[model samples]
Target: MSNEDIYLCIIGLCIVSYIPRVAPFLLLGKRQMPHAFELWLKYVPTSVFGALIFCSIFQTDSGVDFSFSNISMLAAIPVLAVAAKTHSLPYSIIVGLAAYWGLQQVM
Candidate 1:
């Protein structure tokens, strides 16, 4: 293809990709958000965290192995319990990471 044609193709691709991302906010405009939608939005964080934790805990280099040697998974149990009990982000992260490190050192 000619240089001009390639440039036009790139411009077209950019516009196509940008429309899906930008169109939603532009179309939503000043409309009031519905109650159900607002309620659903509240659960997004929890759902995202649960998915992330599940991915991290169960995923391994070779394959899915739920053996006793999974130190990170083991340490996360207490970390999750502490987080649920105290509702503290910093403390939970610190304790979880430290516990993982300690466990790794000993094993």
Candidate 2:
């Protein structure tokens, strides 16, 4: 593709990506959410996190595996403990990564 064409493509991609992200804040900035909806929204992050962790630990390329050999399931134990005790996302993530890497090295 020509340089001008590539530039236009890049600009178009940026606009497309930016609009969906910015549109929510622009639309909701001045609005007051309902109490019930606000309460439900609070669980969204935890629910999403649980879903992602579930998929990562339980699912594999060959299919679902609940065996002891699953590194993600092994790593999740101490990660959950650290998260529960410290209640810090950053620390939990760091511990989880370290646990996963260590498990990889040992196994």
Candidate 3:
């Protein structure tokens, strides 16, 4: 595509991507969420994290791998422990990455 076309495409993508993110805050900033909804929102992050962790641990290019050799499942043990103990997302992520890297090195 031409340079102008590329520029237009980039700008279009930026607007498309930005709107969904900004629209929520723009629309909801002044409103107070219901207590039940707020309580439900609290679990969203944990649920997403759990889903991601399990997907990474259980799935591979070939198929599911639940054997002892699945390093991610093993690494998750310490990461889960750190997350449970500290309740700090950053710390948990750092420990999880370090554990994954160390396991990769060893196995």
Q: Estimate each model's TM-score.
A: 0.66, 0.66, 0.60
Error of 2 at 96 (Å): 1.6
Tell me how many residue pairs clash in candidate 1: 0
Ordered from best to worst lDDT, the candidate numbers read: 2, 3, 1
Q: Candidate 1, residues 1-99: lDDT per residue as tens digits?
A: 999999999999999999968866976776767889779978998999999998798779977758879987888988999999999999899999999
| Candidate 1 least-lDDT 10 residues | 23-32
Point out where model 3 deviates above 4 Å: 1-31
Model 3: residue 39 alpha-carbon error in angstroms: 3.3
- For all candidates, the clash counts are 0, 0, 0
Relative to the unseen true structure, what is the C-alpha lDDT of residue 62 in candidate 3, on a scale of 0 to 100? 74
- Give the 10-residue window scoring lowest on summed lDDT in candidate 2: 23-32
Compared with the true structure, what per-residue lDDT tens digits does model 3 show for residues 16-106? 9999689668869687768898799789988997889789988888788998789988898998899889999999889999999999999
Report the C-alpha lDDT of model 2 over 27-61, residue by residue, as the tens digit: 78687668897799789989998999899888989
Off by over 4 Å in 2: 1-31
